[model samples]
Target: MDKNHPKSISLTLAFSLTALIFYLPANFFPFMSIELYGNRNTSTIWGGIVVLVESGSWPIALIVFLASIVIPFFKLAILFYLALTATNGKHLQLKLKLYNITEAIGRWSMLDIFLLAVLVAILKLGPWTTVEPQMGSLLFALVVIFTMVASASFDPNLLKENPNGKVS
Candidate 1:
């Protein structure tokens, strides 16, 4: 198969754009709702991080910020850049390195999802303490999965560079 095929590049771009569409709602809306003794509270991913920081759980806050926010946004930006440059035949080595970085850090971006799953499963104190995922969790998972697909569809071999760093 031709790794430099235009179809593959366009498909990667499409997925990356779709991922970005999902990202806004995912990060801004409530990810989970906690019910305790007839009281309920909803928190978005950012809100959770803020709560963690406010409560002095600096380590967890940092982890969430890096894993959920920084990594995913960086990946999306890199994916868009890669898609644009895939057919340009320039910066081959640099693009390859960026792709490798994206793949390496992809799994880490799912940390928030794992944490939510654990919380929903473990925080089951009947109706007194129930944790449940909301629309934002679904959107967030979709964003992560779509970004993964976008990265996987991209072919690093397509990046070609002349000695002058121009598409040849």
Candidate 2:
């Protein structure tokens, strides 16, 4: 019964919860604001997806929806589940697979941030047009970061431990 194992589980849960808490505002608030010819447009995660869909970029919209919204949330849930069941001996294989998936999808959570950065860099037309990241962008980045740390802090080997904390 190594103490670090439980500590790792606690850390994972803490980070995952924190990420979940931040996720709401990230999607609801405006992440990007664009001023074009004195007309302003502010877009949240859902708003961006809707705009993409309306612009006939269904594939890109789907990818953004999944990468920015779905994947981070899914990864957080998987990490939370893994932490909760780390000491249970049952379903070790399933837990391991889920943990691996969480780790794999962790990088994708930053897709929104990357896209926002590129947009800001590209759309800096002085006095006519500009793209700026808003508070939601910062919150979204935090959610992604916290979830990544949560996934990384999770000890997959704990799935092999029995209820007594001994490997079975």
Q: Model 2, 21: alpha-carbon shift in Å?
A: 0.5
Q: Which tens-of-lDDT digit does each residue in 51-148 have in candidate 2?
A: 99999999999999998888887888788888887776778889989988887776677888998888887788465898989989999999999998
Candidate 2: clashing pairs of residues = none
Error of 2 at 4 (Å): 4.3
lDDT for each residue of candidate 1 in 1-168, tens digit (9 for 90 to 100): 243465778889999999999998999989999998888999998899999999999899999988888889999999999888776666678888998999899878788899988888778846579898999999999999999999889876677655766543
Give per-model TM-scores: 0.89, 0.92
- By TM-score, the best candidate is 2
Provide the overall lDDT of each model, using Cα atoms, as 2-decimal numbers: 0.86, 0.86
Lowest lDDT sum, 10 consecutive residues, model 1, at 159-168
**What's the count of clashing pairs in each model shown?**
1, 0
